[model samples]
Target: MGNFLIVSAGQSLREALSVAENNGVDPKAVLDMLTTAPTLFPSPIYQGHGKRIVEDTQAAPFRQRKIPLKDVSLFTKTAQQVELSTPIAHLLSDLLRSDEARA
Candidate 1:
């Protein structure tokens, strides 16, 4: 499993591919290495008073999909934060750079 961190408000698949190209990573390879993982953060507020205690059991998972670069709404409402490992970042950088090279 490769790690990639994408920092953006929201971008389409094509935009993401462009980013990957700018980062010098292969778009196809990135799609192939894609994985879907969801993470849920529990609410800090307590539901009940002193007599009763209620805990919120909500978990949100991160959804990863292998999509075409032309799809612009892929990154919409995906995640608020992302963290990618070095190798993954490198790959992405390569992709983005390649795109720039073509342009």
Candidate 2:
């Protein structure tokens, strides 16, 4: 099984919650629905000269060019340069644990 799945940008939290409530789904189930559904908000892109675009495009085009999460490699030398936030650190730790478990 894959370690992670990319969600598109068409699903909304309200819709997810409604589905969960109607289906009596668990928290994980709700999370799975949210993760699998398209994103309701658009990702922001910053251009030079203080130009920015928000939700300007659909995620379908990008979704067509997905890379497996398992293939993501840490920059061994420069990973330390990134600020370690609680959530990001936890995700990295989880990925490492998943890899070790698979091995």
Candidate 3:
């Protein structure tokens, strides 16, 4: 399985601010990254914590012809939860480059 960090948006933002202060990086940059993450990463809404509905049944009340299934959206947790890859996390640390390193 691929390594992933499941974190709430609030927690991630708080951590980003803390990391920026601790590592001398710009917090605004981190916030910008967070804002653009969805477009860049295109993560699917994980529905592990959402409600489930079983459509298949052994018996039905009436006999009907099989019909094409329509698009059904499942319940998912709030937008607060996010799943980030480890490589992206490493890239965040790379933002803490010194002037000499940038040279």
Which scores better on TM-score, 1 or 2? 1
User: Each candidate's TM vs. the true structure?
Assistant: 0.24, 0.23, 0.28
List, residue by residue over 44-88, the lDDT tens digit for candidate 2. Answer: 211110011112222221222223223223322134456533444
How does candidate 2 fare on TM-score?
A: 0.23
What would the per-residue lDDT of candidate 3 be over residues 11-97, giving only the tens digit for each residue?
Answer: 244444557747987655544454444543224322221101011221211112111001000102111145433454343233323
Positional deviation of residue 95's Cα in model 2 after best superposition, in angstroms: 3.7
* Per-candidate local distance difference test: 0.30, 0.32, 0.30
Best candidate, TM-score: 3
How does model 2 fare in lDDT? Answer: 0.32
lDDT string, candidate 1, 1-103, tens digits = 1122222211223454447757998654443333212222111111111001111111101112222121212232132236323443344444544544564
Q: What TM value does model 1 have?
A: 0.24
Q: Which run of 10 residues does model 2 get worst, by summed lDDT? A: 45-54
Question: Of models 2 and 3, which has the larger TM-score?
Answer: 3
| Winner of 2 and 3 under lDDT | 2
Name the Cα RMSD for model 3: 21.5
